[model samples]
Target chain A: MQFGPHLLLAILEGLVTASILSLTAMGLSLVFGVMRVVNVAHGEAYMLGAVLAWWVTGLIAGHPAAGFVIAAIAAPLIMGALAVASDRLVLKRLNYDPDRTIVATIGLLYIAQQTTLMSFGPDARPVEPPFNQRIALPWLERTEEGWAWFYPWGLSITSYKLFVIAAAALILVAIWLIITRTRAGLLMRATQQDSETAQAFGIPVGTVYSVVFGIGAALAALGAVLVVPIQQAHYLMGGEPLLLSFIVVIIGGLGSLPGTVIAALLIGLSDGIISVFFSPTLAKIIATLLVAMVLVFRPRGLLGKAPA
Target chain B: MLEATGLRAAYGPVEVLHDVSLTARAGEITCLLGRNGAGKSSTLKAILGLLPPSRGTVTLDGAALHALPAHEIPKRGIGYVPQGRRLFRELTVAETIEVGLMTRGEGRETRDWVLDLFPRLRERLGQQAGTLSGGEQQMLATARALCLRPKVLLLDEPTEGLQPSMIDLIRDVTVRMRDEGYAILLVEQRMDAILDLADRAVFLETGRSVETVARADLTPQTLHRRLGV
Candidate 1:
């Protein structure tokens, strides 16, 4: 049981990290892929989700499940609305210009962060998970002198973490379904390919940009709501999610969802194992260094398409 | 009818089309013939509002087209087959055409007609358009535009890089669309395809429409002789 328990725990932790990372990164990738807009405020959107979840849950105290459920449903919707308003009111006015959007989103990031600070107060708070049952994990140990079969080692995982993994996966699948099986997806892909032609053929590129921005923010918020139970929601919490999503997106290929998912798993697993074995700072340094190599050698990221 | 009057367009400060006026009526195939850099494409872009003409107006069936955003022009019943057959290389032929349908908020029937026009595309509907040969890509581009089922179809060099057989197919489709009452505006470098299909030919020389010839009065050789090129 020497290394087995440790490995299992690390892997479980990695999977959980990957679940939220991919969810957040996919939104970033999709928004860039379609609208060619890099949402600098993506992390702020995540914080907003956690803040909204806290607010929704606060509305009905003493009922953890109801609060979680209401927050789950309402948080993303509110995040989506906020994103749409930002796109129409800010990004659209800037003509969705790439350089301008970056500045605009940076402004948005601060606006969101400060708004929460002014209204929600500058404090870290935790939301109660709807369920928190512990499930024991099994691991094999070395007998007195030889190897033994698998045995229980008191290793366990919380039920809410399992829900995070399942929910993230379901959302990813739903996204894949929409992107691959629906007409709206076709329009998005078309717009991504040639905005002028997409427009000439009947797509309103501006409207598509607004919708994509909204979806991107909503997905990020969904990931935040799911994790708010385990992680404390704070005004300062947006920084790490934002930084990690950028790493994932850059390493996965700026506009590639599949690459984002794979890179997320790679980063998350390594981050978890490295943090456990070494310092979290060392884990981060290694990840950043790895990204540097990918940039130098494979500029397109792990699975990004080469420019056509 | 699609009528563009005194269209003056520019790329930044350099003017491309100067006071160019033309018309493509429903039920006719009108060809815009010119040499390289002759402003034929610019004229089409101006009418489609992609260039946003610096002067004059483009009206489709009497409503303003130049004032509409490029995306809204198609909704007003104008379809375009841009030069280079700009298909989304990652998308399947069906998905590419489906975009045309989705933009108009219409569905399958137009797809059926497009597939009928280019049965070659029907077999390749599931294939990525970039995987196709040059000829097949041209067909997809034309098919995508036609699937929009526009009152006016703007084709910019449909026969460029295509084989002779593919040329015949595009020529045939152009004539068919004309007979079916789709106003077609085509830009062509190939005199043969122009002669084979154009009901009226407008010769553009250095941003101006120099002469307009009816089908009966036009001969590819004589037109070439007249231009003295």
Candidate 2:
């Protein structure tokens, strides 16, 4: 393919990656931002979403859209419940001590992985897309008569992929509204700012933490549900997303939602483009190098506040 | 009335408050005075259940508070302003007050009354608490607590770092709360503030209540002997 068409395809692929990455990374960032807990099991929650999506859709019949819709709704809610249970049963008991929570979540990661392996098995399973009509894209070119448009070979995107991008954008906006405009969001921000003070003011910080954990896991699950059609569900699939999300969260600035989204775009786009031009391994290496540069130059992160 | 008796609390294995007791009655300002590390703040913490007491009973109007969680104590009509102001730095002044009122399910009337008390806060309602001047932040913290309309208010060094004018404003507000028939427990290091505002004083030394005296009995010699200032 020519450079122009190839570049366009790469950008389209990058948007899909970015869309999914933002949701996954935002979940991790929200958990860290509000609860001050690095949820190492976040990626497992994502895998559970994909696996559950497969199960839920398999349970249903008729139109693919009906199964897809049910799977999307049920998977996240289940993931959220699991997350809340872990938060209450595990993280809360640790008193949310930073070091202790990390260790606890690492334990949770293994437990989730092993449990999923036992129940769902180790096979990678694909979920059918609700609608996947491929639309050929047009390219601009100078002809003998004048400038014209033509269908470029292998330059197209699936309708489902576009839907993923649009859906992610809408979800991000909805999350932004919840954080900035609602009373629950106000309570969350209050707890994030000063939990002791929030508790003193009767904000029920523990309950808030539970709810935040549930929401964070739900978000990651939602992303997984969306991506399961393109990728396959497997117990081990969480490892890559976890590593990529950690990188995005660190580069974007810890716990900053906008920073998370922006960093996801940067990393995701670079990953997609570089994979097309060079190799996926080289893209990951470049991303790691970027994180190192960010750590050395901007340790607080792209948008993280300086320590008070 | 709010009373804490035989209070004992520890951080880790080290007891910081030992057998400290005090009473804060309605329509009066009860001050806790001592040198640093003398368990004044710890006494307040025990009362609020922030540091659960090993041996103590806190009663607010005959209801036991020590058995309750720290967050529950506030919902039972007690407000606290911790040392260092502890404001939600990112929240607007209006939002800070709203958070305080949320537990009590208060409405615009309580918010308006708090705003009326600190009119300067009303002017900066949309400003972030962290960006406010030190004096303004103190006012907002007190204002946020007041929005709860609690029967009891616990303030720990509310005037720790403020200008003379701001100090006077806080003192005036504290006095007004007293006159409004609220039970107030105050922790302070400033002798002038105690002299100006305290109806009764409890002095502490090394985690023990050394003495309890009336404002009139708090002479300079007594203050010098008890506070070591």
Candidate 3:
């Protein structure tokens, strides 16, 4: 492929990765931002989503879209319920002490991964996309004719890939609206700012924590459902998502929604382009170093303010 | 009316409040007066369930409160303007009020009423609470609590760091609230404010409710003797 076409393909691939990553990272960010709890099991929730999506799709008949739709709706709901149960049974008992919650969630991560391994088996499995018609992308060039558009070889994207990006964008916009424009979101932000004061004013903060935890897990599950067709599901697939999300959330700034998206895009595109041009290992090493540099110079993140 | 009896609370092993008790009746500003570390703030905290009393009963019009959690206490008709204003700093002035209203399932009518009381807040509705002047922040804090439309209102040093004009505004609000039949529990150190607003004063000394003085008996000498100024 020519340079322009190759680069375009890499960018397209990066957008798909960025979409999935932003959803996963956002889940972690919301839980951290609101409850001040670092949920180490967040990636396990994503894994569970993928596993459940595979199961649901297998159970369904008829069109591939039918199963995909059912899995999309059911997986997140199940993850949300499980997350809320864990929060109430474990984190709440631990008093959501930052140090203790980390340890507790780490235990949750292991349990979730092992449970999936045992039930779902250790094999990596893929879900078929609802629709994947590939369309050749055209590149503009100055030819003998003033300006000409020609199809670049291998410069194409599946319809499903475009759908994934659109879905993620829509979901993110919905989340933004909820946070900025809704009563539930207002209460969540209030709880995040000052739990003590929120409680003093009759906001049931414990309920809010449970809801936030559930929502966070649901978001991760949604990401997994979306990406399962692109990437195979395995119990161990969570580790990469977890590590990458931590890096993204750190680079984006703690608890910043916009920062998370931008950082995800930056990291995702770079990972794609670099892996294509050099190596995936090199891409990851560069990302890790970027995180270290961010920590050293701008610990609060690109958009984070001084700790309130 | 709101009543707390035999309220005892501790910060870890260190006891901050022991055997404190007080009553705030409707149409009255019941002031809690004491020197520093006298458990005045702790008393209010215990009542609000912020610091759950190790042993006590808080009742509002005969309903038990100490049995509930901090969040539930406010829903049982108590509003608190805590020390330091405790405003949601990042939230805009309008959003801060919205939180208060959301807590009680209140509507725009109450918001309009609160805005009328502190018209200054209406102008800065779009500004973040942290960006407000000290007086404006205090107003926002008080206005937030009032949005609850609670039967019992708790104000902890509402005018502590205010200018005289702001202090007068707070005093007037307290008086007006009291006249509207809200039970007001005020924690204060200023003699002038206590004299002007308190219908009765509860004196605390070393985590204990030592005395209760009616407004008629709240002379400067009594305040000086009880407060040790």
Candidate 4:
């Protein structure tokens, strides 16, 4: 069992990364697809989620699950509200114009980063996972006379990590259902396709834009809350997710939700496996290079159509 | 009365409409005819609040339409089928039509009415609008607008690039809408169609609305000689 346990562990870790990445990247994709704006401040929204998760857990003080559950509810709602405010205060004023909103979001990113740094301090804070029951993984090995199954040393996954994966997947499914099944979802799609015509039909394009922006930020925050336990929450932590999600969006197709999720899976799994075997830096570089190559062949990204 | 008085609008520096005043009364189809760049489209856009007029006012039943935003204009019971029948290409027929009922409480009745109006749409409920033929897209756009249950309807070049058969269908639909008590502002260059359908015709020259003539005073020769088209 030279690398059997290691391989399993890497795969498990990769699944976690993919799940979180999908959530964060889907937000980026949704915002871009609908509003046609690149939100440079997406990472800050994610960071805010993590910090709030930590803060909410601290406030509710009785039990880990109780605190975690409350934090989970509060974080997304708060982030969604903040996102709506941001849209009204900044993006909407800019008229969701592509160039202006990019600059606006970058400014927002700094404001968010600095505000958290000033108030929350520069400390990397941790939140306890709801559960921590470690389940050991079995490995196949050639023992003396015959091949046998045995527990390898350090080859176990925590129940909390599994929970992270499951929670992220569930949230993603909810997002899918919202986009596909709901009347509001249909409105968003119509707005995304043609805002002018959408308006012509009384689908308030402005309101839809604000809600879409809020949902996009809310999704990012949800990912951060789920992952804060595993990855410490820090003011500087948003940069990585922001960068990675942008990469995923670019590779997947700008504004395409399905493309974004698929791209997230590809990037997340590769980032995980590569980080385990080699280096995280190398994984990112490889992901960027792969995206470049994909662009050379399919200019609109994996599933994105050429801009109309 | 969907009325505009002294409407002047522009895109940045270039003015497209100059004092373009016209009225589309209930139970009548008012058509705008001119050559390209004649501010025909601009007139419809100004009425819809898509192009905010720098001068003058638009009123519906003496209520200020110029004060409303583009989306709110539709809620004021004004339905617009823009130039080129700008349907949401990726949206399915059902989704596209449902958009019209966004401001309403329940869409089932309106949806049924839309399906009834355009039976072709009933068959392609799940099909993407982009995949539909041009004529079908025109019908869908009209259906989407009609589903709003608008007091006034705006049609921009509904018969442009359509076959004679499709044109006849659109003309029939326009007449039916007029008969059903919709005040319609139509922008079309098809003189023959306009002559047959319009209750009044306002001809634009360059950027100014030159004159408004009742349908009685309009004919192929008179309309053609005035514009030199």
**In model 3, where do residues sit more than 4 Å from their true spots?**
none
Best by DockQ: 3
- After superposition on all CA atoms, what RMSD does each candidate show versus the true structure? 2.3, 1.1, 1.3, 1.8
Q: Write the per-residue lDDT of candidate 1 for residues A1-308, one digit (tens) a residue.
A: 45668778878888888899999999999999998898899999999999999888889877699999999899989999999999999999998889999999999999999999999999898899999999887565668978765646656789999999999999999999998898788878888888888888878888888888889999999999999999989988888988899899999998988999999999988988888767788878988998999999999999889877
Q: iRMS of each prediction in angstroms?
A: 1.1, 0.8, 0.9, 1.4
**Best candidate, TM-score:** 2
Tens-digit lDDT string for candidate 2 (B63-153):
9999987889898889998999998988998889889889788899999898898889888989999999999999998988887899999
TM-score of each: 0.94, 0.98, 0.98, 0.96
Task: State in Å the error of residue A272, model 2.
Answer: 1.3
> lDDT tens string, model 4, A62-165?
76989999989999899999999999999999988899999999999999999999999999999998888999988888889899998988899999889988
Q: Which stretch of 10 consecutive residues in model 2 chain A shows the poorest summed lDDT?
A: A299-308
Q: Which ranking of candidates, highest DockQ first?
A: 3, 2, 1, 4
**Chain A TM per prediction:** 0.96, 0.99, 0.99, 0.96
What shift in Å separates residue B205 of candidate 4 from its native position after superposition?
Answer: 2.3
Mark the regions of model 2 whose C-alpha exceeds 4 Å error after superposition: none
Residue pairs with colliding backbones in model 3 are none
Writing each residue's lDDT as its tens digit, candidate 4 over B1-229 gives 8889999999889899888888889999998888888899888888888888999999999999897888778788898888888888988888777777675444798889878888999999999999999899999989988888889999998998999999999999999999999999898877777787889988888778888999888876777787785
lDDT of 4 at A135: 96
